[model samples]
Target: MIQETYPMTVGGEEVLSERELLAGVEDGLMMDSTDSVRYIILHCSATRCDRDYTVEQLLHDHRARGFRTIGYHFYVRRDGTVSQHRRLLEVGAHCRPFNRCSIGVCYEGGLDAEGHPADTLTPEQTDRLERLLLKLLRTFPKAQLRGHRDMPGSVPKACPCLDCRNVFRAIL
Candidate 1:
């Protein structure tokens, strides 16, 4: 059962609720046990913030990388629409080594126009992400929230490009 409501505004135009955005998610796979979940890792597409990319494009990109499907469990578009790429139960390819115990969530932008790492999350995306994270936390009560860069042995990269631990500290 869902434990909370996520009401969000995207692009200063449309409003969507958590239920609305996640309504179409299929029960594609089931985790062996929620106990195995240790972290909810956040990521960014690394695309320019001004562009709108779809989940299909990300899937194709992942496929090119030899992944059978998109590497993330969830993908948040620039417009704040959330799409399910892989099921929560499936091991993701977003972060190495931690795949078996982590859930990956990718947002659309992490780059500025000059191609430098930046926190380019749209207001809508930010709002929706907060809600989504909260919901995931409720579902997996033991999981800790983390940024992709926060993982041990990760390369020097600003993935998710935001201090997710500080940003969501209240909820955590």
Candidate 2:
């Protein structure tokens, strides 16, 4: 049977809390004993809207690109199922230079049917993203939210493919 509950790691151990699992993180994952998180960056999978993708697939893609693991800390699927990819305490490969101080959360789909990059977040994806961001904000209270493309020196690309600032305005 398909697993109904997602699994999350807290202090390197698995926890079954649905909210934490669905948020794609646990408390300790976002912070280290000496590390302070400064930003939560949003990204997109850059996949066509008509298909569904998984964190495992993303892991393989990242590995193929020479990354040791999936770069994003969290992966939100089209159906709103959230999956944890990388350990939050580890620096991500999702963004350059700023990776050391940021958490990367990516949602599946940033391309339209015609294969052009677009804001392809489904309603379910949007709702889940909001909830996940809110939960993360509770942990990193002072952290700012930003789209992947908003980072300084970031190449010109609509990584998140949405107005992430406006989408998360109420919480930020």
The TM-score leader among the candidates is 1
| Model 1 C-alpha lDDT per residue in residues 1-172, reported as the tens digit of each score | 5435445543342224554333213212345778878999999999987776788788788766656568789999888999887776777777877787889999999999888899998889888899999998888877999999999978747898889988767777
User: For this target, which candidate reaches the highest lDDT against the unseen true structure?
Assistant: 1
Task: Give stretches of model 2 more than 4 Å off.
Answer: 1-35
TM-scores for every candidate against the unseen true structure: 0.79, 0.77
Worst 10 residues of 2 by lDDT: 20-29
- Clashes found in each candidate (C-alpha, N, C closer than 3 A): 0, 0
Q: Local distance difference test, per candidate?
A: 0.78, 0.77
- With a 3 Å backbone cut-off (N, CA, C), the pairs that clash in candidate 2 are none
**After superposition, which runs of candidate 1 have C-alpha atoms over 4 Å from their true positions?**
1-31
